[model samples]
Target chain A: MTPEILSPAFGLVFDPYVLWVVAGSALFGLFVGAIPGLSATMATALLVPATFFMPPIPAIASMVTATAMAIFAGDIPSCLLRMPGTPASAAYTDEAYALTKKGQGELSLGAGLVFSVIGGLFGTFILILCAPLLAEFALRFSSFEYFWLTLLGLSCAVFIASGDKLKGVISLLIGLLVATVGLDNPAGHPRFTFGLPELMGGAELIPIMVGMFAVSEVMRSSISVAAPLETAQTAIGNVFRGMWGLLKKYPLQTLRGSVLGTLVGALPGAGADIAAWMSYAMSKKFSKEPEKFGTGHIEGIVESGAANNSALAGAWIPAMVFGIPGDSITAIVIGVLYMKNLNPGPTLFVNNAASVYAVFLLFILANLLMLPFGWAAIKSFKQVLRLPRKALLPCILVFCILGAFAINNSVVGIAMMLAFGILAWLMEENGIPVAPAILGMVLGTLLEEHFITSMIKSDGNPLAFFDRPIAGTLAATMIALIVIPTLARLLVRKRPA
Target chain B: MKIGDTVLGALFALLGAIVLWHVRTFPVIPGQKFGAALFPGVIAAGLVVCGILLSVRGLRQADGGGRTIAFDEWARDPVVVVRFLSVPAGLLFYILTSNFLGFHIAASVAMLGWLLVFGVRLLPAVALAICFPALMHLAFYKLLRVPLPWGLLEKVVFPS
Candidate 1:
């Protein structure tokens, strides 16, 4: 359905209480996103329980608003400090930080905020128009199709681990292994529990995610004991002075980034980080001045930030329609929906059209809201860089603990967070990419279930994967991606160094 | 890269062997010939092949001065590793103590302990420890009604 048909449901979000919730959540998201170590996923997870008393529209509004704001807010830390506030922001961090060093921090933040809003709105527009069509197409995905989809996601681990593909594969395997810890799929017997009752349900994703990203970050920060960041002594001239110039300079770049971001975000298990990187790589490829990319270029910031933010809206497209989360943040949002007795899928659109429409509207409103909020946040958050590490670290630690505990109200979750934090640190030290590991954890169960189901339906014939046109195409894509990279490397090696 | 590849490869191989071994114990279904173990078995085989490839690559690269450990960096800052390790250790402790102290109290205590271990001062640590959990209590319990465990202090404070 078009956005015009969705207008009636948009009125539901205008309720006073819902607006308040949205604003409050947006502010909270800005705060978390501004923090160096805090992440949007953690913010969403912590806020999930807070939505229990609200109606579905308000709950979803709070999540969508907060996520949109948080995703943009991530650029604040990346611009002012070298550290990324969220994983999604990591792609643009180098360019943003370089610009910051050049006294163009405000310009970078401004561009990020403006382009992010544009990207987010564009994605929401696509979501509003294409969700139904995509949902219909998604319904065509049977067991074999799901297996290929999961395989495509698994192959992305290689793309992410471009420097060391083998280590990437291993990390992915570890994640899958971790997923197998709970009850056995077919027989319902425990596989790797080893008599631990707490593990019967396997490792909880929320705690593991928080531990891996947040706790591990906190630990890394503490050891290094970073010096207080120094902001530009002079004011960044006219936040919007060169906006028209930027649009003119990189029209094609921004459009490419937005499209790439939306597509990647729509893929289950691929989130904004991947989108940002893909966009950046593509932008570099098409740039007339690729050499200037890492040397404090506004195009890099605009491209990556816009792509990442748009990817957030794109993530919701698959999630709201197919009951599949595009990333960890969406996974938490899905959990919240389930808690509210709102099952997301084809039935959700038919039953709760208003709530879904409200979500779509919130995506636009959140981006519009960023115009003012992001401007003020950029100014104020720069002040936060002056806070001593000793003072700030403890506060972050408390938040991490509370965030972990709030997940299941179980200490086990907290413990899992800490364990995973340490494991993450060790993995990093050993040069293992944590992203692939997380991808494995997120996609493992889905892959296993679909694989077994497809196998059973085909009577153990693996060729069933090739029988479906769409599945075969996706599988072919995966094969091409793997083979083409190796073949290119071989060709390059054959040339004289 | 060498150390990373070898460790990852060996670990994968071991995990694959374990998975393959475990699958043999499951009873096979009659007509549905591809039982529960089929998926895991395929994954295990893939893991073994990948693992062997990785190990060979690792061994080949190990002799080229690429396998050196970061011993100097480790020695310079053992606190980094210790602090990193503390996160999981503290989490385990919190999990063990949550039922006894309740989720809130256990969470607060764990936060305080971690902050201290990470080298935060006592006053700020104590204040944050208390306030953070109290805020969470308000947010989760009072607002959302998720029902956090209150333990012995429940009767005196909440009285609900």
Candidate 2:
């Protein structure tokens, strides 16, 4: 926060190389996010191999810029074709499409663009103000506290993030098991290498992520590859019109969405999609015209659009301070953070203070860049949609091949990608949520490391986990999160009977 | 494939049993009870319990069709099935052949197969299949220095 550190951070982010990376990533993100089935997480996963060659700041810059633009650009397809480009857009898709049907498409698209920028900037402000303070507090934590925090995060993934709780647990266990496939444990006992040298180094995160997010999505898209994409509105005109009036009309809703979105985004496991969904519901619940929600109303769009984009920045809070991902996108990011030797934790903030400020600066720049870039994306909606899925999907598959291969520069990476791709496709087919599994994969080793360290420190006493004050509170919260919902459900069932 | 919860649960439970049994022989930390096996052991046990719960829940549901496996509507269409299967088939083709055929040849053939199977016009499919890999070569091989294998084209590409 000092002027000295701030100046260097500004220098880092404003470099010509970093700006070029940011600009290139913004366009790449918009293209990927505007296309249906190419999720924001997939954009991050596919960008990993490219970032592998980049310096830490540019690598971080590319992902930050791409994801911010991608989230906003996702609004384009939802508004035009009624097909949400990413799950975050799914919440307000019907409302946006309804606006298009009612000839208020520009209004809907305008609110999405405007509110998203507002929310993103708002979230970045919070990040700048809060991350350093949290990092300072986090410095006092012991392994016990970290263990509870990681467990709390994993619990949130299962309880709050997924629809089917049982399936979510299963998916998470699968990821944790996969994470145990190396000789890097405390005892250095090769548990699951199966005599392979590559396995001893552990299952690579980049390849597995590409498989889970990108390859599985491609597989799902392949089934409906022949379905024609038809746009409801052929041309968009002046999406900025009426935006100011709407902002004046719904200032409260905009602030509420951004606030709630940031809070939810900060929570582990829950991300932009969940934030958008919850904020949209809250908007309808609080609005004077609740009945106008589904029928082309711009109010819900104003709130949730801002909410989703703000949630993007919100998710970064825990990621930077605790090394725990707030969403699947950040889950992929945590891996990159580790690869760049900028390991996430309180130590990161202390040691690489300049890098931390650079990230904050990048968030602000990316959000500001969204207005013009999103405008152009909406204006050229027809050309974006004209790329046939048949042609585009194969190209993506090739890209996936290269992305996976580039990680290890070996066919083994592609092999892992293929295997996990099929596994992920099957998991999704059976209603298992993949986000928890990914979070598990990202946090599993760290969780184990902390657990073992705490156990040894406490001489193998199970109750020592709650010995620390912060650890006890986190443990209590985790327990309540798991127990309260089930108890409520049971009580409701009994009353109904 | 839409597998019934009962079958999926049983598979997971069986897998957990295997993991637990296999981890039994792993030596513990000297003079300490817990070791490398402890974490995976707990996870395997959780998998077993969750699997059983899932199976019971699946059995209690009326919509499970009393079958271990079922095909969704898309799976019933043979053409759709081919398209669906082509994705993995294409990736597998690249994996088995990439090092031998080199990245360029292997990727082009795989891309061509996917494009054709997904019903792109032959002309455009052929064009994309060739051009996309070359573009990738410039990005990955030349620019990024990914060291993509050249296979039969190595002699022509490098002229070493």
- The best candidate by lDDT is 2
Model 1 alpha-carbon miss at residue A354, Å:
3.4
Instruction: Give the alpha carbon lDDT tens digit for every residue of A310-370 in model 2.
Output: 9999999999999999888999999999999999999999899999999999999999999
In TM-score terms, candidate 2 sits at 0.98
- Residue B66 displacement (Å), model 2: 6.0
TM-score of every prediction relative to native: 0.87, 0.98
Worst 10 residues of 1 chain A by lDDT: A225-234
lDDT of 1 by residue, B51-151 (tens): 88876776688464333443435445666667655656666776677666876787788778777776778998899788877887776677766666767
Interface RMSD of each: 3.4, 1.0
* Candidate 1 C-alpha lDDT tens digits along A1-497: 56654776667888889899988998989987887766787678657546756788888888888888888988878877677878789988889889989888778878888899888888888898889776677777787877776777667655643357877777777787777667757667576776877778776777787677777776666665644555543365557767778888878877878888888887766788889888888888788889998889888777877899888988888778766667667877776787688877766776777677778778888989988888887777756555666555555555566666666666667777877887887787677777667767766777878887788788789888899898899889888978998899899999976
Tens digit of per-residue lDDT, candidate 2, span B29-124: 789877889989999999899988888877987986424788889988999999999999999999999888999999999999998999988998
Candidate 1 local Cα displacement, residue A160, angstroms? 6.3
Best by DockQ: 2
